[model samples]
Target: MTGTPNTKIAFKNVRRVFGDGPSAFVALDHLNLDIFDGEFVTVVGPSGCGKSTALNIVAGLLGVSAGECRVDGDIVTGPGPDRGVIFQQYALFPWLTVRENVEFGLKLQGKEKSERRKIADHYIALVGLTDFANALPKMLSGGMKQRCAIARAYAVNPKVLLMDEPFGALDALTRVRMQDQLLETWSKERRTVMFITHDVDEAVYLANRVIVMAARPGRLQEIIDVNLPYPRNDELRLSPQFAEIRNKVWHAVYTRSGQQQPALEE
Candidate 1:
């Protein structure tokens, strides 16, 4: 009604169980989440907390055993171009040029050679790698390679961007830079994105909303509305507000892990 608007993606009593019959292990338990279009949401929790599994379910790579996951008003069935995933590992083709790798999806769609080239270059430049468009994957830095991977995902123009610790492989400094670059690119592209990361700080820094999940037999623990304005840079990271969100998320994680909740910093 007059409260929150309708969600672009909705998980209705979703339950995901792997294997079959008695052997089935439920990853998500009666989970319900609503993600609005163009929203930047981050899932953070303990390892193997079904965070990635939730992303996979939304991507249609996995199916729910008990409920339905809907995207744009339709139930999810299987992997489709509507979702683009970026994994922790830079899943780039070592053989393909940055441009070729970025445009690979368009090429697969049988777009003409020139068409693919134009599309690829646009995304390459979007990631600030226009000069490296001709370089092979092995030649780029770890951060640059991930940028290409991000560009590759963005090139497809998916309705949702699913990222699983996409910066988990980079060094601390590099990770920060990548976070800034991702925010930069996302601001321009405005695609609905769901990212999974274990870092509470990263989750709070980038997300418009942060979802914290419980451990195995993973279930939603808390949903935090960041409500932080755009152009969030390192300066924002230094604010007391940012620390408050981080501490809140950290406490949630600690509590979920069966440990005492951490105290908030003064």
Candidate 2:
């Protein structure tokens, strides 16, 4: 993970606009970025700054209005199993049990019953949800539901993981805990990740690099590298170096957005 990590994802002069003519609202403005393979990059910005929009383009859920977005040097045309997405709301099927939800993607791929169960079980255990595998989505807490979402995303063996504020709905305590859980999962399975979040602290804590975007017609503002030691934990959050980087990102977000105060606390 040194020198150059080989660009797994690249956004070249990309632009995304909604509507047409005078009513058009530009979400992204010629934004360019490169994410290396096995790199964990977190994007943070003010509301409507195209953070999620960028992730969606990488996920192939949305097409760019201009230029191109590529994964592994190929233009992102549409969604593929190689890319997995975890949304803010846990996109689980209520009709399905926990195990079933985890296996949904595998089932879609026409995996045999036993193989689906095996992959689902492995991810369930990885996320520490083995005991709740038989439960329904309604029975799980916010944190637990998110864990299920993570397990489901990882079950398919995606090469890239796209997460859009997956822990935004959780309580402060739970959000911090989920951040650690997600890092642990990523440590074991280092997929190229593009995570979008509004929290500067979360960005600083989890990302190898924090990508800051400007508002209106969103564009890259700055890239802040988090040079902290790996295998990070809650104790790292209390470190002076961590606080410094967090504040740096906070200031960058506010400055880029022209806000007098931070939208969220670190």
Candidate 3:
């Protein structure tokens, strides 16, 4: 696949296999995709569809069996500060306060205490955690904890954000709120984001393009473009345009041939 100047994350005929021998399983098969700079892309598919595997490859946590993955024209060999990752579970340091947690990456980079405080304060306020900056992780609710995690990721100023089901663990109401909050932050930061989720509404609501994968040697099944405008809200979610795009993604994920349907919530 040819990459353009705007391509922030490029997967060039990528493949990933687990184990060695006849019993080996292929997680990804000849996947080719390019996520442009400042684009919000969401990936959705049934279970075991290499959704997380692909995110891990971009994050440099896993190696591809064939082909290559690149960030900003450089091949990814391992994890780097240029890419920030957020998972379903809030991976905050329990012993640390929100400000300290957000400053952890900067501290690791040998940033002085004063500079770390300045950067941490900015992201903490951006995520609406300014009041809770001194509170420990145990003092925050699930949604608040996730917000703190996001603040921490942004504090490092990564060019790309790889999120794997980051809102999966939250309750329904909180999940919706978190989605809006994330979009607001993204609009201001404009970082390239590759978010993986199982929810169809979320996949359509938060993405410029929704990537649907097919299981059993996971590969791309379809790419549905969400033509809706930005600054999305609850009213937009109820519109016909939103419903049409959501249905397209739903059909692409569930109606594939010879695939067992998994229990996925809309």
TM-score leader? 3
Question: For every model in order, what is the number of clashing pairs?
Answer: 0, 0, 0
- My TM-score estimates for the predictions, one after another, are 0.93, 0.96, 0.97
Pick the winner on lDDT between candidates 1 and 3: 3
- Over the stretch 41-99, how does candidate 1's per-residue lDDT look in tens digits? 99988776799889999988888888888888888999888889999999898998998
Instruction: Report the number of the highest-lDDT candidate.
Output: 3
Kindly list the per-residue Cα lDDT of model 3 for residues 141-247, writing each as its tens digit.
99999999999999899999999999999999999999999999999888999999989999999999998988888898888889999999999999999888887
Superposed on all Cα atoms, the candidates' RMSDs to the truth, in angstroms, are 2.6, 2.0, 1.3
RMSD of 2: 2.0
Ranking by lDDT: 3, 2, 1
Query: For residue 63, what is the lDDT in candidate 2?
Result: 99
Pull out the clashing pairs in model 3.
none
Evaluated at residue 104, the lDDT of candidate 2 is 93
For each candidate, the alpha-carbon lDDT, in order, equals 0.87, 0.92, 0.93
Steric clash pairs (candidate 2): none
- Candidate 1 lDDT at 119 equals 82
- Which candidate order results from sorting by TM-score in descending order? 3, 2, 1
- Error (Å) of candidate 3 at residue 133 is 0.4
